[model samples]
Target: MSTSGRSRAAGPDETPAIGRPRDANRDVAILDATLLLLTEVGYDQLSMESIAARAGVAKTTIYRRYRDKVALVAAAVEYRSQSSPPAVGPGGLRGNLLTLVQWLAEQIAEQEIGLLGALFAGMRSDPGLAAEMRRILRRDEAAMTDQPLREAVKRGERLAPHAAELFAEVAPAVIVHRIVVAGETCDERFVEHLVDDILLPLLRGHPNKPARTERGTGSKGTRS
Candidate 1:
């Protein structure tokens, strides 16, 4: 979660003028500063001037890289997301999902509650930020589940229609609700319950049961 002293090359969209490369160290500094300020003061109170001062860069430097706070914050969020550990597990649908849920829980646990609250509030108040956040989440959801679902199909397991879309909403929603709204811990037991009791049932049509079909059978199937 801490991005201090970490540097990455600027993405294609962030490229600077010819022969004038963007400083990777400065990019890290600015993103780190933005995240820190966001946690402390929330999006409404954060200012470009404050970020520049905190990052030890000129205001124009930030403006040159990002058009405004919205773009800067989105970039910071994307950077943090990219920095997180990839969700990998043993080769099985259930095992992969368990790893994904655990990975998501760990990511959420690393964030400051104030930062979460700030983001929730900002989403309510700023349409642009909300859209950007949703887009980022959707992209991540696809990345996390694509392999597992595809592997399941290869194993002759039939997924309900729209299974990916349904799965994308369930685990994160429940985990975030438990931690952020119910103010409860998202421990191992909870993750297991969510996967075994809820998600598995929804996706596979029954707990611990694989959805398989006989050849040339016209059996009705469930949509995930």
Candidate 2:
């Protein structure tokens, strides 16, 4: 009448062996709270105590998920960049790239002054945070860049030899110029100039794809 191998109740100490289900809600809460704090005070100012208070979780929870402030900040940036759309489409390659670049610009502009100041300050104070920032930028941004290049090339449009790297720096350049030098914000016209005046012309001259095919429909760069 007794169950030999089939136990209905799991032992308390055996939970680890069974591996209790991870709470998706808790993970999301932690990530959301981290991003909120990053946007509010940035990498330099965020702390475990503040994050726990903001997330309404305990310090142990924060520590369990992340090692320190650097890990937390990295997670936050990773979450935001991941959540954002890689591209907005239906307009074809040019339109898609344009839309995506505009989106990138807006995202950067949203955190313009605060981001610059905080990370710059953090680099001087915390080496781990500095390294984390670099990793997040490199890894997360490369995600969107690779696909855009392929789509552009497939449409008979030439992708610049270093399109990904070039595009990565473009949005931030305008932000730096505006917030640091010109003391202003970038508008749609500026983004258009970067895409039309700069990025497009260079790609056309590349050996793979060459031509000024407006809107990227009729040209069909060899169709991958």
Candidate 3:
């Protein structure tokens, strides 16, 4: 009964022989409701019945489209993030890094820290959810960092051989550390300082610097 792998736009309309056509609007409603509930109730407290009530749909509709709560939550997160991705970084490594860092700060500030805490807990508790979240975040991180770093190296910039991994993680890692651990605000000033002080140095450092032993240690730096 799971429609998990079906295309987002491919509803029951595609299969006339099936029961009543699936409403794309209802799909949006469900996702929107799920996201709202996630923010308001936290992942552990969120339930399909609650989402159904918020969305004005039956629990069966939710189950028909998603395999479980984890799938539903993952879909909702993806739905929202894909709709409003951080703007693509501009030219130059500095500019690109600043852009990414600033955007992350803005998003974290806008959503507030509590929601992020809930996300962190949810990801830690559920393997399936964690994997899906990591996959999307890694894709976005690569999109932001890879081309810019490559271009910087081509532009006569002296970058470490592992700059791609190390430098790319700077902004997101520091931002999260500050917000979650240090209890600091992630603002424009914070982002600028991060880009200027930490990221640039790492990128421009010698390749001989000690590297992190674990491959996944810093992957998906941000919790997107």
Give me the candidate number with maximum TM-score. 1
Q: Kindly list the per-residue Cα lDDT of model 3 for residues 20-52, writing each as its tens digit.
A: 777889899998888788888898898999999
The TM-score values for the models, in the order shown, are 0.80, 0.65, 0.72
Each prediction's RMSD to truth: 7.3, 11.3, 8.6
Model 2 Cα shift for residue 21 (angstroms): 5.7
What are the runs in model 2 whose C-alpha is more than 4 Å off? 1-45, 53-56, 86-93, 179-186, 203-224
Per-residue lDDT of model 1, residues 130-174, tens digit only: 987787777677776788888888888777777888887787788
Residue-level lDDT of model 2, residues 1-224, one tens digit each, is: 00012111211122242356756677677777776776678666788888888878889866766666776665555544434545535566667667766666666655546645666777778888778667666765576566767776777765557777776666567556764677665566565555655556654444333334563454333311
Stretches off by above 4 angstroms in model 1 are 1-13, 83-91, 182-184, 206-224
Q: Of 2 and 3, which scores higher on lDDT? A: 3
What ordering of candidates by TM-score runs from best to worst? 1, 3, 2
Better of 1 and 2 by TM-score: 1
Worst ten in a row by lDDT for model 1: 215-224
Largest lDDT belongs to which candidate? 1
Candidate 3 wrong stretches, greater than 4 Å: 1-21, 83-91, 177-189, 206-224
Question: Between which residue pairs do clashes occur in model 2?
Answer: 155-221, 156-221
Q: Which residue pairs show collisions in model 3? A: none
